[model samples]
Target: MHIQLVRHATLRVGYNGHILLVDPMLSQAGEMPATVNTPNQRPNPGVELPMSVEEVLDGVNAILITHTHMDHLDEAAVRQLPKHVPLFCQPPDREKLKNHGFEQVIVVEDDYEWEGIHFDRTGGRHGTGEIGEKMGPVSGFVLKARDGNEPTLYLTGDTIWCEEVEHALKSHQPDVVVPFAGAAQFLVGDPITMTKEDIVQLAQAAGNSQIFVAHMEVWNHCLLSRSELVEYVRANDLSDRIQIPQNGEKIEYQR
Candidate 1:
């Protein structure tokens, strides 16, 4: 399996002869509006995508959206991505994608199979209390090759360390785990995304699974940086388990 960190929570995953673009926020740097109720109220996407827009879209046959938040599936993405490609999303996002003029929007209510790949939808808690409730429904996914030729992957959408995450980790026991870890926050609530401590706890719960993290240093609301996460990983003696990939960097895994 091959995974490339495009930018922020966006990813390109290659498995079973398919290139799946996950949660693309495709606008050029500063083109989008700033996130409200947060520090660093600057325009979003603090930096540009490591590659050009065409390069990012190249070879993408499918798109998987964990949620419809602007950071995950922005207007730019809706404009740029081909409308005909298979779009897999949660049930709540079905109408939104269709309304955006997408031709193929498939909702995953629980488990779905396409092109010999198994997708199991998992639950998540975006935040706590009122904030989490307002954030609405979010989901993660467990992907595995039906033939068992590729490593199992668990993509945890915007979420903190909660019961849902722990349950997903325990139930799937994926070989590759990708968590959104920017410690993103709003003005009033606790972090809506995983903090460094939350990442550590995830590492422990995931057993021997390799943890790859991004969604850092891109948006204004994100509080974690790559250097800080690296330092924390080193200090915790988790250098081998946690990986912080640079934008557009690709990592390959063998099953």
Candidate 2:
């Protein structure tokens, strides 16, 4: 499979003659409103898109959206995408997409199969305790290529540490796991996502699975730096197991 990190949590995964664009934040820098509720906030893409949204989406067969937050499900992407393109998302975001004119929308529950690809929908918690309750519900996706030779992959959308996440990691046994890991927080409260230490623990929990970290330095709420994260991971001897991809960079794996 070929995985392209297209800024923030957005990714373009290619496998079996198909390209699945996940959580596309296709808007230009500073074009969308802040969803994290921070003042003086601005969108920073960190790098230009590999191509225009149209160019990148030229032959995409489907779109997999985790949620409807502005950063993950931007209005610009909704407006620019072709109406006929099929959209798969969690239940809460289903009506929202239909209202936005996505005719071929599918609400994923538990697990679903498209063509030859298998998708397992796992529950996610955005944060913990009061912070988590405020952030609302989230979902993570596990994609297994049905070709029977490709590696399984899990994409952990915006989430904090939770039992369901650990369950998915252990039960699915995915070859690779891509997690949103900027250690995001707001001005008012503690962090709501994985810190560097959390990532290390997650890596250890996942055993030998390759872990790819993204969602850093593109927004103001996420304060962790890639260099600092890399240093921590290396110091913990996790450099061989975890990968920190630069914006617009691509990683390929085949099993």
Candidate 3:
């Protein structure tokens, strides 16, 4: 399995000979407005795409959307993506994507199979208390190749160390785990995404799983930077187990 950190929470994954894009926020730097209720008022995407838009989209056959947040699936993505490519998402996002003129919007409520890949929809908590409630529902994905050559992959969509995430880690025990870290916060309340402490906890419980950290240093609201996370991991003696890939860098995994 091959995974590329496109930028922030966006990812380009190659599994079982299929190229899949996840949560594509394709806007250019400073094109979108700054996130509200956050400390930094700079543009939403603080950095530019490491590669050109066409380069990122090259050879992508399908898209897996965890949610419809603007950062995850923005207007730029809706406008730029091919109308016919299969778009897999949770049930709640089906109508939204269809309304955007996407020809194939498949909802994976529990588990579904397409070609040689198996996609299992999993639950997540965006945050806690009223902030989490207002943030609404989100979903994660567990993917496995039917032939079993590729290792099991768990994409923990925008969530902290909540019960649902713990449950997913325990149940899936994925060989490769991708946690959407950044510790993104608002003017008030706790972080909406996984923090460094949360990552440490997850790594401890992940057994022998290799963890790849994403969703950092792009958005204004995300407080965690890649450098800071690297320091924390090294201090915690987890540098070998946790990898923080730079934007557009590709990582290959084997079972």
Q: Which residue pairs show backbone clashes in model 1?
A: none
Candidate 2 least-lDDT 10 residues:
38-47
Per-candidate TM-scores read 0.99, 0.94, 0.99
Please give, for residues 1-255, the per-residue lDDT of candidate 3 as tens digits: 899999998999999999999999999999999989889999878899999999889999999999999999989998998889999999999999999999999999899999899999888889888999999899999998999989999999999998888898888889999999999999999899999999999999899899999999999999998899999999999999999999999999998
Tens-digit lDDT string for candidate 2 (95-194): 8899999889988888888888888998777877787787877899998878777788998888876787899998999899888888888766666777
lDDT against the true structure, per candidate, is: 0.94, 0.83, 0.93
Q: What TM-score does candidate 3 reach?
A: 0.99
> How do all the candidates rank in terms of lDDT, highest first?
1, 3, 2
Decoy 2 TM-score against native: 0.94
- Model 1: lDDT of residue 90: 96
Clash list (residue pairs), candidate 3? none
- Among all candidates shown, the one with the greatest lDDT: 1
